[model samples]
Target chain A: MSAPLHDLTLAEASAAIARRRLSPVEYLDALRARFEALEPRLNTTILPLWEAARAEAQKAARRIARSGPRSPLDGLPVGLKDIIDLAGHPTTCHSRHLLGNVKAADAAVVARLRAAGAVFPAKLATHEFAIGGPAFDLPFPPARNPWNTAHHPGGSSSGSGSAVAAGILPAALGTDTGGSVRHPASHCGIVGMKATYGLVSRRGVFPLAFTLDHVGPLTRDVASNALLLGAMAGHDPQDPGSVVRRAENYRRHLRKGLKGLSIGFVRHFHETDQPATEEVAAALEAAARLMAREGAKVKPVTLPSLTDFAAVNRVILTSEAASIHGRWLREAPEGYSALTRKRLLPGLFVRAEDYVQAQRRRRELVAAVEAAFAGVDLLLTASSMDPACRIDDAEAVEATYSRQARTPFNVTGHPALTLMCGLSKAEGLPLSLQLVGRYFDEATIYRAAAAYERAAPWAALRPAL
Target chain B: MNEDEAAARAPGLGEAWRARAEEVAEAAAQARMMAQGFRAPADETAEPMPAFAVPAPARAVR
Candidate 1:
């Protein structure tokens, strides 16, 4: 209890709640106070569900007192990216287009979390429809990085990353199609996981791309990320993309050291393919060394070019996103922010032949990644090629946005988790490394991440917001 | 919508829209070139990844 209430990780808060040492109401009050102080600076929340969250907290406290907790997430607060549907709340998506888009049903993931007795405190900010970059023209101002308010928090899971990193929330959900979840996690110095495609149901979450969209969790640390993912993962028959796998105790393997594991370091990804900055490269190297020292057999592994994966990802994403927003583009082109319109507009020109080729190429890329996993238990690479650039600097944002190694996994449908590996000495921003696991092997990813997290100094380093 | 139809409707939207369309067109052209240019190891007979299946017949209510 030495730490501030808001500083408790999701796992810590859950433990405290179970022991009856921390009342859910008191924890919620502490977080609400933090939000009040920091929300003005961060712009992380689009809709604050303060009153409802208070009622939920009291209900959770009473339920725990009467019998026992429903789940580890029973009394914990989890923020939703605005694109996620919560019954009777508008899934605004930070665009003028859907200002009145209130739905009557919860998203599949939301329903699952509600069943787990998780409390929803706010609808977090995201880029328009999870495709656009940060923009000043959107209905809601983009979320700022808590590490340095002047720097960009990666998006389209901008607020999810910002809030969790800022310690305003212990955990939040962010949808990743082409690195939305991991991008923010990388920039905000937190843990974000994009489990294998179909591992988490995407129903009721607004789509960026039908084949590629994935819903993921963002938390301050690796174990909390795994815990959140445990509560969120399961099959929903209604969601065509949801895999029919049994739910997992994601944290079960956290204590398992890296002794018997073989890690494939995709050096070509951050070096030859899309060159990362010096600090990021050094951090990745240090992480690989640390893992090796921790008993993981780390070795170099190669896959297809980052360009090829990026092209395939972009082609499919733009094509599907364009199709979904086609009517809007035709009818109300003016409603979209200029950046969003520009980003979505490219899909219109993507020929059917091009899209088909992309998908065909995607199959090959997936196979390529799978083939690489033949010798290794996991793949290690850079999440973002550089630390976050300033949010207001459009040129820097544009230059650094695509300089990432994440889209490859989105294309390949592998489970990838990004966590802080080190900080950039020059800028004091967090530098991140990625751990990718085989399909449906998130527990192993968490194991390796937890191992590395324990050995590295990054987990204890917090943004001085 | 097809490229021609988009082009036909784009200009009338406004200058900003037109400019955005132009930027998109340029970028799309580059992406198309890159996608088309990259030769996959797979042969011409390779099928795209998405598989389509016929839906099951609905049961009649008793």
Candidate 2:
């Protein structure tokens, strides 16, 4: 109890709880206090259930005392993006459209976490239906970066990333279709993993783009991310997209170090395709060097252009999203923010041939990415082409939004993770690097991320609240 | 639905709102055209991803 309970990572807190050094109630109280002090500035939570969470934590404390711990997530406070279903609570998707839409059952992932003894303290904010950008016209204000309140914390999982980075919670679930999870992690200086497509069930989660959408975890560090992912991953027969493989112990390989690992550093991604800011490019180089020092063999590799992957991702996303919202657009267009309406309207114009072509090209793109891994165990690239821009600067936000390497993985359905590499000198904001592994090979991503985290001090850095 | 019908669906909005929606539609149209035009090298016979599969009958529980 020497350190504030809110400051402990999920792993550390779970360990303390198992040993009776800290009770779940005490842990939840600390996080509740942190939430009260920070929520005013961050606007992360849309439906906080702290009292209910505290009651659940008390039960968890008693259960653990009677019999060790259910899992590493036992009694840990994990938040959910508002689009995810939690029985008896409204799954609003941070839009006025869903303000009255209450859920009658838990999302598949939520049921898994609840079974693992995790306590839900709040449902976090997200971009409207996970497609719109941060808009002032939304029912709730967009979550701000904890590193600097003036800057954006990346979305559509804005609240998940901001809350974890600000020490309000150790972990939160975020969905990524076009880099929603990794975008926030990149800007917030936290760990976000979009595991291979369909590795986590999406049955009760609202879809942005059915084929491209993925549920993921955003956490303060790599180890905790692995633990949370382990708890969340499993086959769900009810979910059509769910993979039918047994979930592996993602943390099993965390300590394996980077020795004998061959990493393909996709330099063209941040260098030639979509040029990153100078500081971001330099930090990526430093991260590669750190990995090399850890005994990883780093080599340059190439894939299709950033535009190619991004185009395929967008065509499919917009087309599918358009189809889903066509009725809503025609019936209640006034309910949507201008930004969401603007983004969704484009999909209506896309031809059937265009969507089909994009899907066909997607196979080729996925194969190209797989071929890039021929001589490598993993791929390294930039998560965000630049550090986060100011939240209020719509021009800057629009300009830098598509300038990233993350959409490629979503297009290819690879397990990709982004974690803090360094802090930007000029703005004092976090800069991040991404590691990608073969499909369903998230363990290796965790291995390399943990190694880099141990060597670089960025993982220990916290935003001054 | 066609683009014209899609636009007409949002009737009775403010002039600025309609203008903004028009701009968005125009931009989106251009982007879609560009995406359609950029032909990445792929086999002519490559099938679209997420290819449909027939669901198997559920197995009887023991």
Candidate 3:
């Protein structure tokens, strides 16, 4: 049909490979060609695992030659965020530190993906240790937004966003501590989900904030994110934070329409707490109105002050991050970009009362999200408070890291997904909304996201880059 | 806890309270580790082993 490739979703690829209509080698070669063509413009990757990918694809072809496609993601190449360990590959979280830190063993999630027959082609770029970034002094240049290379791909999972947006990888592994994954996905016009805290294993993941870090998938669309999440969903005893959940096929409920689903709009977060740019605000309105018209109920509601939650998240995230990076901060302080080191240093000075008050406030917000869900099936907000910004604006970068719209959920540990709503006039960046689901009920979130994606096509438009 | 919950409780987590919790928490952690495959290793020097020290650099964050 289309070179057995050409922007086919993971679902389509899996079906074609199962029917023997497409070979994994052909898919990998096509993917590699597209990546090679786009890498210069996108600037989204640090390492491109060509030889390893070829070897993996040949093995997948043989396995399919013996046994028909085993999993929905069989033979698909997934880009992993560089911070996550991949055995034999250096997990250099875009920092000078850990320049040669290759894993002797695969992380629990990597092992699972290997079992699912997914090929990992490269370690995608991330903010320095998933905190300080978009600063060029680090080992790797910050990933450019695929939409406009001059624009910022919102960090800290900057590369994950750019690479997935450029079609270099359909599905990617991204960690969300403070919307590292969701912000970029929303910024880059892709599907990004931040699963509930403890829903996915973070054992081998380099620690940012031990309390807030959660790993999830960034994919081209809903179905592909589902496949990637399904492969990596279960608990591993190795990670103390991983909770035991019954293995549920994440994609099985994809077709469940949003007929009677209920969604609460955290309007105050946009309206007053920190008003979203007019374009972002308008897009959220359109997404909410569209979702409601499609069948799900949408109504305006308020949770904790977005500013209050942001403050709590700032204190706790930085405190824990400071704990994790304190040794590094003291040692290779210059090894860090100025933004991360300075931003993180405040954590060391934060009073224990602030951390505790934040956690105590967290309990309240968790109750608030729980209370909101009682009246609604999901909660919606602008994924990023605003759209992409110019990479050169240092104060804006500091303000951004200083005032992230994402930490509220990280505090409460709810599952949130970012879906592109429309284009924004502000900076001509992609505007999107965050669809947050009840704890452990990502199925409902996926169903709603897929329905919105189905009703309004975002996957059709690629970044002008 | 709310004020009511705090009032109901005997006392709250004060300075000594944190100290006491840290002690008990450390003991509980050791006990759990002993129960698991990992036995608590003997305590050793707790000096900070920083990876690299910035050479006379002033705070440069804006």
True contacts kept of each: 0.26, 0.21, 0.00
TM accuracy, model 3:
0.86
Give the lDDT of residue A218 in candidate 2: 96
The reply for model 1, stretches above 4 Å from the true place, is B1-21, B27-34, B51-62
Tens digit of per-residue lDDT, candidate 3, span A1-465 = 554374777777888888998898888888888888988777677778977988988998998999876687778788889988888888888888888888887778888888888898888888888888888788777888888788888888888888888877777889998888898888888888888777788878898888888888998888888778878888787777777777767677778777888788888877776777777888888888889889987888788776666666666777788778766754456677776665565565555544555555556666677777777778888677677787888777756653345767887788888878888764567888888877777888888888888888665777765
* Candidate 2 per-residue C-alpha lDDT over A53-83 given as tens digits, one digit per residue, 9 for 90 to 100: 9888888888898997888778888999999
Please give the distance, in angstroms, between residue A301's alpha carbon in candidate 3 and its true position after superposition.
Answer: 1.5
Residue B6 lDDT in candidate 2: 59
Give candidate 2 misplaced runs (Cα > 4 Å).
B1-24, B27-31, B51-62
Q: Tell me the lDDT of candidate 1.
A: 0.87
Considering only N, C-alpha and C atoms within 3 Å, which residue pairs clash in candidate 3?
Answer: A262-A377, A331-B52, A331-B53, A332-B52
Order the candidates by lDDT, highest first. Answer: 1, 2, 3
Task: Output the lDDT of residue A191, model 3.
Answer: 88
DockQ of each: 0.18, 0.19, 0.02
Cα deviation of A6, candidate 2, in Å = 1.3
What lDDT score is found at residue A318 in candidate 1? 86
